[model samples]
Target: MRGRLRGIRLAVPLLLSAAVVACTTTVPGEPVSQGRVISRDQPGGVDPKSVVENTDGGEIDRLAATVVADLRTYWGERFPETFGKEFTDLGGGYYSVDTADADAPEPPCTDSAVEVEGNAFYCPTADIIAWDRAALLPVLKDRFGEAAVMLVLAHEMGHAVQNRTGAGLSERRADPERFPTILIEAMADCYAGAFIRWVVDGNAEHLQFGHDQLDSALTAVVSFRDPIGTEATDRGAHGDAFDRVSAFLDGYESGVKLCSEMTVDNRTFTLSGFIDAGDAARGGNLEFGQIVESITLSLNTYFAEVAGSGWRQPQVRETEGQPACTPDRQGPVAFCPDGAAVELDVAEELPEIHDEIGDYATGTLITSRYALASLAAAGKPVAGPEAQRAAVCLTGAFTGSLFQREQQFLSPGDMDEAIQVLLHYDYVARDVDGASVETGFDRVTLFRKGFVSGARDC
Candidate 1:
């Protein structure tokens, strides 16, 4: 997985800055978007052929047009409610380009349609949003579903909202340190999250969004994550997968108020460059066995010290296949209570994941069982949902601790690796009974709680 493309760079729409004033509103309103409500009734029947210029009115463009209309519904109410201003339509009309067609009209901020190929952007100067109907939207819809298209459009519209609120690109450039690009991008994500939540809450009129769609939304968002090793303070940096997801989740969980309130001082961005050139040369990954040895030792020290009195370290053993636990299958690894051993399959399974997702994926999986053992030692039951969640949380806590290590420390993309694993797998949140958390979102939430607040929060 080191060289494989895990996330697409599709998330980088042109980001200018934004600002806002205060307003008041209430929730508990009827929504018109799809999925939960499953509404197909369009308020005025959005026609991209007329509304968007240079359009073929193809399926992708039609979908994008619907997303734009829904954005109007959500933000028309949201903007005035949150920013104390009446919402206004874009001064510049939306544009759609058939990048595959040489005759397609050029969109704002680009000299030719070729430049906008496989891209979507909000041109701050022109106050317009444009997209490559031929490439970007279709691929997102195909790979991640309609919600991905919805979220991407929402994110681009978020740029317009930023400008409307007076935090336009000019303000961002005026105060780069205070309103860095990362924060701007995060705030935009948060706004998109707010829009998604609005739709999921059944407030949209032209789209459908449900609980199951969140995973697809997240998967799509992460694909747009910043290039590995981007510093949080870099002028053009968006953020790593974890940070980007965190921003989006914050918006989904909270609201525009919370998103608008984000500051460099208040937000936590876990993005940075490699500690050294040698570490970068190695791709910031330790060998499989070496990672297991190092993290196992760190886990023992971390749990022993954190759990304190009555916490006993468990033995680590490797097996060819599954562990010999009496019951319950813990994927490739298990914490055995009968013999007090953390057993794992070392022959094949782990090495593949190690090579596929980086060594830290294996390390994080191993860390969870170690966390389970610590839970058991602390007299906590190890066979329930609470235990499973706690173990995952502690795994995150331990991963966080690796940041400060003098040696065997976390590499630049380690947390992103952890994010990828937790987003795709449930093994980290499995208890001895094999019971697990219900969703990847919940598991990631628990892990994030631990990472942000440390083991104490877990």
Candidate 2:
């Protein structure tokens, strides 16, 4: 089961659109909110005879039961086919703990009820899964909605699956390099992805997600990602947002076999701990002013290497509000071909974003404009749908450079900020006329390609 040392709070801010594109993008269709994906109307309480019968979390109990029942049904059919053997149900059964009550019973792996606060885990030895319904589930639902609770429990079930398939604790610890904590965590995330696909395909008994809800569900997944700067080799390592989402998307798109095939050799992680003293000194963030200066030079250097002598570096113009442009764009950042320059409202807009999201968010904006410039250097159009897609793809390529430790470094939480911005606004991935060409899913998928394959691929 996935575990956490402390409670993590993910506070997402409002998204604002920026810029104007030559032709407006086809806004993606959205799903109407129909309350929770896993409705709290299940017939039986979650593990009826379990501790939940004595607790006050009836709504959560119903949701948990619905998800667990569906999870069991899915694995019951899939596991036997995958392993050529029958799946074994957990004998120790499911459990819930009221972490807030001192008199509540402790889980198998813990000494006291309070120890289960803010956590959920699957104990392989006892063949049971436990959760702090009072503390963990409520807080997760509040921050990320019911989808998160489903994800957490599904991840725990993934651990149970591992135990039954010979890849248990002994296997995990026996070969730390092959099955490190991070990779193990990623596999569970991938399994969760696989299970989510079953639900998305209309196969689950009690849950269904619409297009927009799945997008929100992806946001929920992002929130559970490991803290930035956590090394992949660390004992408690889960993964950086990019790595975690990549694993989940892999399973979501490809299915269970992909998750089962994961290994340290095959899987790549962008998550990093402290690289050196300079990083430690800065607390994994570059100052806003410093970021602008550093990124401009870096962008020019990168494009020159990729586009050769034809590459003409755009002059970086700092602005306080919307810059004067053809038909004027809506965002604080704009790319102008007339002057062969990019204008940034660094006075408040850029700095505010930098302070709120992290330096890479500003980096994504800078690189996207530079991406337009790269297209211009190649004699590619900067005003159409292709241009918009290319710009986002190039921004992704530049982001990939951070993983490689090229010039600028990607601090912790940078990827999360990128996802947050992509979901909330469109400015960072817009074209010359200020229109976004892709859905949040498409934008992220294309960016993932560029990130994995580099600028040459873009």
Candidate 3:
């Protein structure tokens, strides 16, 4: 009953036709290696409060001060090399607002101190950056760690980079076609990714982020995604989680050159919302059983098309717990090549993932097993790095193809769900031997490759 074809009644909202063109950001480098995350405080050379306005010398302010100081140092060195010009520090200076403090002075570029609460941003005209040290930085640090705080300032600093480069500003935004807010936000995110990479590579004088933590850093990145149904071309649209993560990784993997070169024509934007009222009312969600039923059929049909005459459909079954394999154990879901079957834990994890992340997380996990089966049918080994790469890539390829179909089954946040699963879990990248790709960032990269470049790349 789990994998049985139940007449294709899946709920996918919005057309993915917007997801066109292969990703132009093919960075040349080995994936970021996995190891223990190296996070440490900056060596004190100067007081952060001396540089930042309205600073109380709190822990968050110290962290932010060091981060900004490092940002200045990074851009100072890189800007001349990349742009044939010298980098200039913020003219108006940085401002740290204690939003909870009623008597605190107003932050630059904003009228009220409350306006700066729980937010961080670059004020282009004033050439200043401001943040809520009290609320925003604390919460970001609490939830996603210090890297989250670094990511925020780096992104705002990226806006400063754009302002100097003439790529961003209200005057230039008259032509929404070329300068959409989403694209601008993407460029900022890409720049942040590039800076984070510098920190990750042990280049920052004040920061040392482990490559292993890039996954959580990215998790912090997607937390800034624009709310669903926000039009991609809207004046303030920031982009969906998938697009945001893609741009960020483009910078991390490819460097600032790729971030600088981004444009509307070159990037894909799949940020549309529900078209059918019925689906909208239902929140574009199919029940767990319905999701499993519809997605399994969809995956089967999709892979069959890819493999053409050679595709052998893998058996599907729901076990009380994880399915037994001789030695392979792929978390809650396991792909048993010995029996040519995909066994999932109906009793736990998958359902929780669907309930927590969304329907597509489960779909992404299920699709990878079929990817291994397809590899086996094609006489390829399903137990190595190649298999691991192909599994996630194939999963992305299948997800990408949904946009091309007349029958739409992927909703707005579904791609985000896929990303969530890729970043949070390794099951999608698991080989038949139960070994999986090590880094979530790398897993996302491989999955993004198939989605952006299509199945042919896989």
List model 3 lDDT by residue over 1-458, tens digit each. 11222110000111111211001111111233232222444455336777798899977888888888889999998888878899999998999988898778986566677766667777777788888777777776766677777888888888889888877565355576787777877888899889988988888877788877888677776676655556666655677778888888898889888888888889887666765665566566667778777887778888887777778887888877667663337867777867468888888878888888877788888888888878877777889899999999999999888866665567767777888888878889988777889988899999899988888899
Q: What digit string (tens of lDDT, one per residue) describes model 1 on residues 99-141?
A: 8888778876676787776667777778888877787776666
Residue by residue across 377-440, what tens digits does model 2's lDDT show?
Answer: 8888888788877788788887777567643356666776676566546776687787785456
lDDT of each: 0.75, 0.69, 0.74
TM-scores of the candidates in the order shown: 0.89, 0.85, 0.88
Model 1 lDDT, full chain set:
0.75
Each prediction's RMSD over C-alphas, in Å, is 6.5, 9.5, 7.4
How do the candidates rank by TM-score, highest first? 1, 3, 2
Candidate that would win on TM-score:
1
What clash pairs does model 2 have?
18-331, 19-330, 19-331, 20-329, 20-433, 20-434, 21-433, 21-434, 22-433
Deviation in Å, model 3, residue 254 alpha carbon: 1.3
For candidate 3, the TM-score is: 0.88
The residue-level lDDT of candidate 3 at 50 comes to 70
Task: Enumerate clash totals for all models, in the order shown.
Answer: 18, 9, 1
